[model samples]
Target: MQARSVAGEAARNLVTGTTRALWWALAFVVLVGGLAVADARVLVRVWQDADAFRSAGAAVQTLASEREQVVDGTRCQALSGVAGLTGAGALRPGAPVRAASMPSSDLTVWEVTPGVLDLLTTTARPVRTATGTTTGGLWLADDLAAALGASAGDELVIDDGRVRVAGVYTWPDDGRDRVLAYAAVVAVPATGTFERCWAGAWPVDDDAAGLLYSATSPGADDLRLGQLNSTRGSGYDLSGLVDARPTAVAPAAAAAVGLVLGYLAVRTRRLELASALHARVPKPFLTWQHLLEAGCWLAAALSVTAAATGVAALVGSPGPYLGTWATAGMAAGTGAAATLIGTLVGVLTTREKHLFRYFKER
Candidate 1:
């Protein structure tokens, strides 16, 4: 087959030449890998580290009627109501109030379930749970409990509610990972609890089957709406969950820049070959035509290697791995483009031997 001959010649060139192609390839790999690491640590972390997407809701009128909804994970579906905050003041006596059974000691450690917590590692504080309750209580966030200076079995008042320390924990911030630190949790009565209001509520779990909510208007109206029951609405799927598209882009860009440099390095030695073929081939052939072929092949090979290595490293560490095919494809395309541009420059200069000589002299 004609394909076989081309493949054979390409292989021969690789081995026959003692040119610095191998060295250049090694340099390209190092540049790409180093840049990738730096970009991921700095640029990608900036976008992915902070809470970019907000899960919010709005409520119209006072929810007087009893209503309940089950949640699976701490997803937007679990959000009850993004009810407009009517009053801009803190919760005071006689004010309308909403309470969640699963309280969160800290805002970052969003309580998704009774004992489970979810938070980005960059949130600063982590959750710490204690076991074997005593005089006070056991449930507390790591920071809150640490601030109390209480150890296991020690009694203290949190938000006015007496509690006992249990345990401390550190969680990974990677997007896919979930923290199921606590298993069993019981609420402390608000009467003797802290005066804080927001601390008494926590986000619903994404996987929780239902949501439980109660409205209280002290000294105005107190009605027993027995736990309202409601199931999550349909059409709720996690198909669009986990966005690595943005994260993958940065590395792809860096890889592209490296690929361009690689193409230039390769074409430097291939100048004579490209010139010889020019006469045998189409008249006035663009240097870019030959460079394009080399560019595509180089990008294809580099992209595959980068993705495989990136994925392997991500798997071993706490960072997100290349989860989506789109990410890999984008990375590959970026690399290909960079290589093409770099090769084009090199090949174009070869057309003018004078320019090529100037570059060598410089």
Candidate 2:
């Protein structure tokens, strides 16, 4: 009966000691937990954006490759009186037409008809000159503009004539490092038959392909034409920007901070642990006490992290929240690992005999 009373008292004392120790470090725990939650949110958003960007880039690449194959394989001549070709509406009697060709020197020059600019409303807008005049000749992509050392209102020599640099524009696939430029087709010499055409009312019907093939060259089996629809693919890749290095840094730092704090907490209770050990408490019981204490601290930290995450989601934005079970699982796992590691280190370093010797010396 006496032994049972001592065991009960020891267990109660263990709980009280754990509570006192945790109270001293509650502020630290809250601070670390809050930081962890913030990092998790940022990480989740960045990862999602990165994945979306990568998928878009892949789609763009596939489309570009297919377009290249079509352009390389076909020799096409203009077939008059052909209607319903994809983007053929832009060629209405008075409507402007845009023709693109690569004559030489890896340069693609586009000649846009007068009203063609309006049709490109979704593309980057042409910038006006400082003098308030609209640039009237050509719009270059930023990379192309930089390559020529030209800006808005500047003049660039194309086919022996100077064309005004209207402004810079970017395509969605430009994120994949493509070079793009545009100009009034008249500025470029009437080259070999135009290779590609862009119109406002691009066709999406099943018969559109047949219409295009029949329009290019009827009765000529040697010539093949292919259509490239740029509107169907993704536009960007952010994988490089959101790499593993940047994503891992925050969680790693949090784990290290948590481990250090847990270690300190454990060290502070070494004397209590040694006393319990000297009182003939089984090693398993003592180990269980340490683990239980670590678990309590970890649980408290996780609770604070969850609460902070919920509050931020409610007070901040109206979009779908990104936090998931995986995120929570990661945070919990890291916190628990740090706590258990600290507990093991503390127990191993401070022996029961060392505590008794220190007490005798005191």
Candidate 3:
């Protein structure tokens, strides 16, 4: 019965105070709901763009500045067994050999284990032109493939050996690095011992940089580590492509919008509220009533915001639907909570005795 009375009173206030109700519904809804929609869509778009660049593979590229003995294959195997490591592979740190090829090419042959090649070119594998399924074969860069007049299954004689062109692939076309365009990686056969001069290890944790250097570059006679290098290659610097300030700024703006709008709405009814108080209406009831009215406005706002964002989700880049919707909900809920706080403060602090002065000024 108490709940019914409070809700009825709140609805009555909105009915009688139609102007204030309409003002809050239309004006504040645009202000608050617009912010929520922008925050959600931008967050989702950035996340989708981020997903294209993100990979579990390590970006750190280790190279030997000085001549050193080949790190044993056991080191990589040990790295695979470690906690932070996802996958480990090695590459030929030495210079690629300029091998003889069709039409006489300027490109060179570099050796990479099947695993390391997978780490670098995970997203850019091109289609095979011929029918052959062999892992221990040659992978040509698209430009290099065209230059050599090569396609998958074609024979290319390099200084290392005669290897078939497995396929063509593209490195991440980040618009800066051209090294991959002129390079070809030969995947060492499964049974061949690793004669690695370069190493690639994918680490799952952020603190694994030190572990990578220590594990791959051990200090011992007949064994030495290489210089730690960043393999970003136009990619490492691309992670920060989106501005992240909105993540923190949007919620704070919502709170401010809620607080200011909520307080103004309550103040408009201060004189009537004071008279009701002098008639012995409970402060708690008034506070609850104010909160309920504010909640109604907020619920309406959120509905509009959700609808707008839903349309955006359909048109925007594909991102996780649940997560984007959750982002909208959380932003709207934050504003609603802050509005309720402002309503409560307005209800408690307004005294009936001060109503005359407050009205006189208006």
For TM-score, the strongest prediction is: 3
Residues 1-362, candidate 1: write the lDDT tens digits.
24444445445555665334455555555555444444334333332322222111111111221222222222221232333221110111121111132244332222222212222112213344445432233444343345545555566543445544444443223231122222222232222211111111122222221222222223323222111111222212222223433454555665567556745664565545444544453312444334434643465456545765465445333333544323433444465567656765665556443435545654
| CA lDDT of each prediction against the hidden true structure | 0.37, 0.46, 0.61
User: Could you tell me every candidate's TM-score relative to the true structure?
Assistant: 0.43, 0.44, 0.67
lDDT of 1: 0.37
Error of 3 at 166 (Å): 4.8
What's model 1's lDDT at 158? 38
TM-score of 1: 0.43
lDDT of 2 at 260: 72
- The clash count for each model shown is 32, 2, 1
Clashing pairs in 2: 111-185, 112-185
- Ranking of models by lDDT: 3, 2, 1
Model 3 weakest 10-residue run by lDDT: 227-236
Considering summed lDDT, which 10 consecutive residues are worst modelled in model 2? Answer: 86-95
Q: How far does residue 130 in candidate 2 sit from its true spot (Å)?
A: 40
Sort order, TM-score high to low: 3, 2, 1
